[model samples]
Target chain A: MIEVSGLTKRYGPATAVDDLSFQVRPGLVTGFLGPNGAGKTTTLRLILGLEPPSAGRALVHGRPYPELRDPLLRVGALLDAGAVQGDRSARDHLRWLAASNGIGPRRVAEVLELSGLTGVARRRVGRFSLGMRQRLGIAAALLGDPEVLVFDEPVNGLDPEGVRWIRDLLRARATEGRTVLVSSHLISEMALTADHLIVVARGRLLADTPLAGLTARFPTLEDAYLSLTSGHVDYRGVA
Target chain B: MRRALAAEWIKLRSVRSTYWTLAGVPAAVVIAALLALHASSLYDGASAEAKANAVVSPLETVAAMIAQLCLAVLGVRSITAEHATGMLRTTFTAMPRRGAVLAAKAVLIGATGLVAGLATLFPAYFLSRWIAGDRPLVFNESTLSQDLPSLLAGASLVALFALVGLGLGAVLRNAATALGAIFALWYVLPMIALNLPAPWGPRLGAVMLANLAFQLSGDPPYPGALMLSPWIAAAAMFLYGAAALTAAALALTRRAP
Candidate 1:
């Protein structure tokens, strides 16, 4: 379980995430929805303790993230898809992350097969396509077999098959009683995958509701998301 | 902390630059030793004092310095590449403790420095002996003290530069600019300072790290005009490196990803 309370972050004159609070429970997939620059990424960073909160705190499994023993075993995070060293082969890339967490090389090979990256595992990450890099990122996240997983825009450039693969993978992990928090702009795909929704706009929480209620009230998930966030989105003039 | 160390080790092995840096030590040491050996033997017309002083000892220090650039680049690359590619956010997210992460990186760098020092010392010692003809170089007990300190100091300089490079990389986050600043501070500025007239000139040169480095080696134990004792100078350089690290950690940990 991930519990965040009164989380706030400000950048000089601009307040990025303000007084935000929410809980992401286990045994479900929680989709974090927000417009561009809505502080979705910032919120994840704060929760994972990548960046300190301006106010308040975030706890994972009843303890702060930094205080956790074997954090990789507790929280598996993929903040960006292409985070591996470009000159390193995909297999070597995963191997090091696994080693970092005391995970064996066998597990590294397992993630390689799981992510369907065994074929291109020997190829350098710099040469990978966007979809290939996405798989590598997911592979790294799953290396430690963590109970809570955080993915920021996992399906941004994936093909139809790749998208289906991730959807099934996330669902399977959730089925195993793991907590999953994924941020994405693809409301349609998220509608099918997410059990719960946390919507934000301009760094403020707008809605934290079940997916069924959102779809039942509005014709579709996208329509509901648009309605909730439309007012908060700023429209800029085209030059 | 153990896990973080293991993770950093994995990171060190995975990157090609790490190997490249390691490879440079031997290549540089061998080349510099050979060149110095050849020059000493060929210039027979030179004074006995010149010949004795002109042994491959100084060249080993120079080669070690050249090898350090590679290590510095590797050290900076360890964090900066992650920052440039946005991997550091993921690393912090995985590990979280700012001090632990920095500690892990420092351990890895120190281990690498020790290995690099050993590699350069042994080969340069023998190569100089071979090229300097029958007149023993490293066999003399008196010279061993000078040679060992120079060896250790050279290695420490490399490690120090690597740490400083990491700190600068953290502060600047741009590889090219950080490297440029390190190069100018270590090499260019020192050269310019050495040209001025003594008292002030030597004083100015004293602060010039390169000259300070040469003075600190003291193979023949030259008269001092520099800032601090060798140990103190070494400590001061490390302190500057630490400041860079502190700045970087503060900059990164406070800002949102």
Candidate 2:
């Protein structure tokens, strides 16, 4: 389980994530919803200890990420698919990551096969297409088989087939009693994949409800999200 | 820390840049040394004093100078490339102890530098020895016994520069900027210091990297300049490496990945 309490991240005069408090429990996909620049990425970064929180704390399994022994064994996160060395082959990339957590080549192979990257495992990452890179990133995330998985915008550049693959993968992971936290701006995608929703806008928590409850309140998940975050949108272009 | 070391080793070896830098630099140095030795042989009418000077200060030192840049770039690329590719986030996420990550990188690059330094220096020394003909060379039996420590100190200088570059890469986090700073510190500043007027010229030049490497190799200071003894010069270079690394560690831990 991931727990964030009063998590605030500020840059100079602007606050990116403001006093955000929430819990992402196991056995369900928690969709972290927000508009562009709504601090969804910042919150995930804070939770993973990639950046220091201006105030408050984020804990995974009752311990701060940095405090956890072998953190990769407890938490798997894919913050960005572009955060990979293009020069290294996919297999080599996963090999080193596995080594970092005392994992072996067997696990690396398993993840590569699971992610459908076994055929291109030896190809340089620079040569891979966006969909292929996304698969590689997911393979890296699943290498540790952690109980908690965090993915930010996993479907951003995916094809329809790739999107369907990821949705099925996430649902399967959640079904296996894992805590799955995915952040996305696609309301329809989240509506189909996420069982619960934690909506935010302009760094502030707007709503925390189940997907069914949200859809029942408004005609659709998108309508409920737009209503909740309308005032919180940081930028609005002229129609 | 052990796992981090293993990971860093894999990361360092997996990149083609590492192989190109490590092998290519030394290969170029050896080839240059061979060419220099061949050219020296054509100096048919050179006086005994000139030949003696050539034997005492082998052209291999010049080869080492060029190799220094290669090793420095290698060190810088090891860290900066990760930042450029945004792989640093993945690295830090997997291994949250930033200090361990930095330390592992240092160990990997430093060891690589040490091995590359020795690899280049040994071949250069032996080749210069073979090319010296009947003339007495620095690596001769008596000189080897007397100057062995200084020669090893010279080899260690490359490793020292690599560490400095690694630290600068961590601080700057950009390849071009870090490389520019390294070039300024390693080459430009030394050239300026050596050319300055009077007391300041020799004084500042004494601490310059090239001058220090020369002094640590049991060579005289740059013409009419003051310099520390061989051991003292090595110590000063070590201090520079330590300070740079300390700054790098501080900068790394303070910022968000």
Q: Number of the top candidate by DockQ?
A: 2
Q: Which ten-residue region of model 1 chain A has the weakest summed lDDT?
A: A229-238
Question: Where's the lowest-lDDT run of ten residues in candidate 2 chain A?
Answer: A64-73
TM-score of chain A of each: 0.97, 0.97
What CAPRI-style quality would you assign to candidate 1? medium
Report fnat for all candidates as fractions from 0 to 1.
0.72, 0.91
Q: State model 2's lDDT.
A: 0.85
| Residue pair clashes in candidate 1 | A100-B7
Report lDDT (Cα) of residue B98, candidate 2. Answer: 93
Candidate that would win on lDDT: 2
Against the native chain B, what TM-score does each candidate's chain B reach? 0.84, 0.90
Interface RMSD of each: 1.7, 0.6
lDDT of 2 by residue, B25-120 (tens): 567567756765665565445787775664445555666666677789998998899889889999989999999998998888888777777777
Against the true structure, whose TM-score is highest?
2
- Displacement of residue B82 (Cα, Å) in model 1 is 1.4
Candidate 2, residue B215: lDDT: 81
lDDT of candidate model 1 versus the reference: 0.78
